[model samples]
Target: MAGTLKVGLIGCGNVVDYGHRPALLALKDVELVALADITPARRLIGKAWFRLRERQLYADYRQLLALPEVEAVVVAVPQKFRPRIVLDAFAAGKHVLSEKPLSNVPAVAAQLVAAARHSGLQLAMTHNYHFLPEYQKLKQLLSQGLIGAVRVLTLHFLGVIDYPGAAEYQADWRHTLAAGGGVLMDMIHAVYLAEWLAGAPAQQVMAFVDALQYAGREPVIEDLALLQIAFPRAYAAIHMGWGAGVGGLDISGSDGHIRLRYKQHQSGGFNQPIELYSVDSDWRRSDHAIPNLDTHEANIARSFTQLWADFRDAIREGRAPIAPAAAGARALEIVLGAYASAVCGRVISLPLAAADPVYQKGIAGIAELEAWAGSKTKAAGLFGLRA
Candidate 1:
């Protein structure tokens, strides 16, 4: 709590390797004091990346939490196992920053919210889209009523997991349905960002999800998703896929509209400017200078720099983080709600009741996938599969 906040990382996975390390290094007030990973190879990889001493390496995160030096923790592990680790960190009296989706299941996510509130510790979620410069500009414009009375928003993302040689899907947990896999997992940022830009929670959703291209290799998880979300006094459509094409957003308001463009750089791609356009009366169109934030790397680490700064400040001030667990929870609701609607061929309402199965257990709780979208999910339980 004093000089650089001593931080421990719980998962030495891809996001940690590429994103968290860079963000932590970029923050003057934060220190990467120690790291814990289950995989020995991953632990060594992190040590080599951060030049961590042997004493700084840990296989069990609990041991890292036991250390008095660590003041904060970043839960970058898979969504399924994160609830336990996050709870443990709070129990250890450390503040926490968790990866997106909160958890694959909502019940577990609820537990985290309860624990963090009772523990009186800040639990920040990595809903970092709001930090991007372009998004910031758009938010500013809307706040000024540049695009008055936002009525609808449509976000589009098209492209396969364009990792060179398909690296993202190759032997990755993201390819597994039970792990909260596919476009929803990969692009839940869009859901959260939509809410941020729209200024309201989705009231209902109807969607279609399928694995259009990866039928042979990874047949269970969905790669293509088209979701329609209904908001009070507004509407939103989000389409993302592991297919191919251009992607962006078109937001229409009573006065005008805003268009945004972005690309997901797969392999070591640097930051790219986000192009935004504004249209006004008399068919007047405004050409805008590019925004500086890079969309290519959220999970890769670039965007989290601001996210970390906010988290650090919030922890110090005894205030709520910029992006809290509630935002993440809403995104999960829209996501799992989409899955439920797609499965049942019915328009699923949002902020689902506690008794709704998907509200409690995520996509695995859906009982009729074969009837509507017909996804080939082989999920066995909350945590395991038949693999």
Candidate 2:
């Protein structure tokens, strides 16, 4: 807590170029001690970015984990390869900061959370959207009773940019079913934000998930997902897609309503927000100024920086990080549930039953469920559902 925190990084992918690199460079109390990536080019890129010596770079992440100076590590690999590394980190007595969606399978994600709890090591999620200035202000207003009791929260991210993975790896991995689900799974940010804003865990979820953009190609994953989720006392609807479409946030509360519009109708991380305002019961409109009004790129960098700081402080104070592993697990279940709902045409419950195939195998288990004749996901050939 007093001195610097030494950290190692795994998976030197494209996310490091924008998301984590700036944070590691900006946080004075955190040092990037080592980096690991299977791809040599990516490892070299990280070496140059972090100014790490050849000895500090590794092809096997286990070597980086072996370092005694690394008190913590950030796991930035794809969801499929993360479980083992994270488990190994906890076993090695190192705190872990994991990227989103925890794991492709809900059961596996739960196991990671349990492992972290049993090890008494931190397992924080990179739900950095919580630290974004717009979302932070939105949470502030909601907590201050600006919207009274939240009734319905809608997040529109239809214009998500389809950025590819590192060229050294599978660039089109996201378009495959192996990536888990699709755009919604890739951007699980809206899912966690829904729970955080609703102030409870999701109870039930149903969705219409389809590959509208790649429908003609018989895509293995969905490009558009419309989900309706039920919390204890509030509801949230998330509209997500990978193509050009609407993008913004709208909240309808008992006392008032709030709306956020991004510039150029781009998604949250793509462009700066141009408008944010609220309306009261009396139809009085009030505009809220965004705190960090720099370029969207700078805002995103700041969010990651704050997230790393929170991770550091949480470790020092023996407290939970702003985004904990439990939240990520729940979000993963919500997404897997949504995919199940699309395939089976039924609302899926939370903390899915242990006996449920989807709970055990994630999107891979959708084929085990009875499919509806009219299910759009089935029609679109997503999640192994045949028309």
Candidate 3:
């Protein structure tokens, strides 16, 4: 590693534009050497934003990777294409940073993780929430035992989305099943926070899924779901939805409990702290203050700075990243388990076997809903959704 590693970034989508690009540009230790995006407009946008020359802008990522001066790569591409891109970056001897769901296919993601470990290159995931001040404060409080021995984790994530209607085909790829889009796409983050707070692996998962507004339209992916995960020493329930509901988290411990929330709108943006409460009944009740912000996307850029710093330090000091490939792989595996549970119509024990159909077929477990549907039309709505 040199004093300043030259960076080549792929994907100029929303995340790269608002989250990573700003963070990378602000870092003093690295040069933004190259950028790649399929969209010509986006390529020009990055070229102008970072002041890169036309020769440094590329339509094909491989051309960017060919740069001998490039020492690392940031991959914010779609979940499906990441395996190939990340693997290519590693083959090109570049340290990698990737945006999550690691892979829509767990098996392929596992391979990517293995490559990072065996290749001796750092692989960082953009799970920036873990780096947020509020979450950092929560982690600190837990370490101090403000709430002792957390046993239950509950998260309610509610947001609104217009039904795809006749324009389903033209909707954001996140709304499509083939792209691994669904209410649970961010379920991995909730699962990560739960495990981080609880200190255990989710041993099992059981879930129910619904497309709701698209009930009779045979949605390619669900927009609603409830995931129940059992840990070795505790349990977690995650309710994810695309329509009206409250959003928050509750953590219950042997001695006390903590509650946290946010208000999300298209305009004001995310993580606008609603409240944080803790009470033990014997001890004093505490109310912690949260941020008042203009946009959640702003904090995304802020937290990403910490995430990128973690990546840089890991590469510099030869340590694992704050959010490593294994952590992402574990979270991804649990999410897939919930999908399998929905299809199998039963509790799914985790450490899902390599041979599990979902491992290779990705969300292919959803297909089983067809056979499982039988004469149970209502049941089919859970997965084998019909018109």
Rank all candidate structures by their lDDT, best first, as comma-separated numbers.
2, 1, 3
Q: Report the error of model 3 at residue 66, Å.
A: 1.1
Error of 1 at 55 (Å): 0.9
Clashes of 3: 1
Judge candidate 3 against the unseen true structure and give its global Cα lDDT, from 0 to 1: 0.75
lDDT of 1 by residue, 1-387 (tens): 666888999888776656688899888889898999887878888899888998999989999999998999999877778888998999899999999878987777887888899999989998876776666777888899987888889877665353321123233667666567567666788888888878888899988776656666645566777899988878889887875455777889999988877545211123343567889855589866755644566533656888898999898888898788888888888888877766667898888778887777776677523344343232311112222
For candidate 3, write residues 273-376 as lDDT tens digits.
66678888475789876543335666768788878888888888999988898888888878877777766668888877887777766775556443344223
| Model number with the top TM-score | 2
Off by over 4 Å in 1: 160-170, 263-274, 293-302, 368-387
lDDT of 1: 0.76
Query: Which model, 2 or 3, shows the larger lDDT?
Result: 2
Against the reference, the lDDT scores of all candidates come to: 0.76, 0.92, 0.75
Evaluate model 3: give its TM-score: 0.90
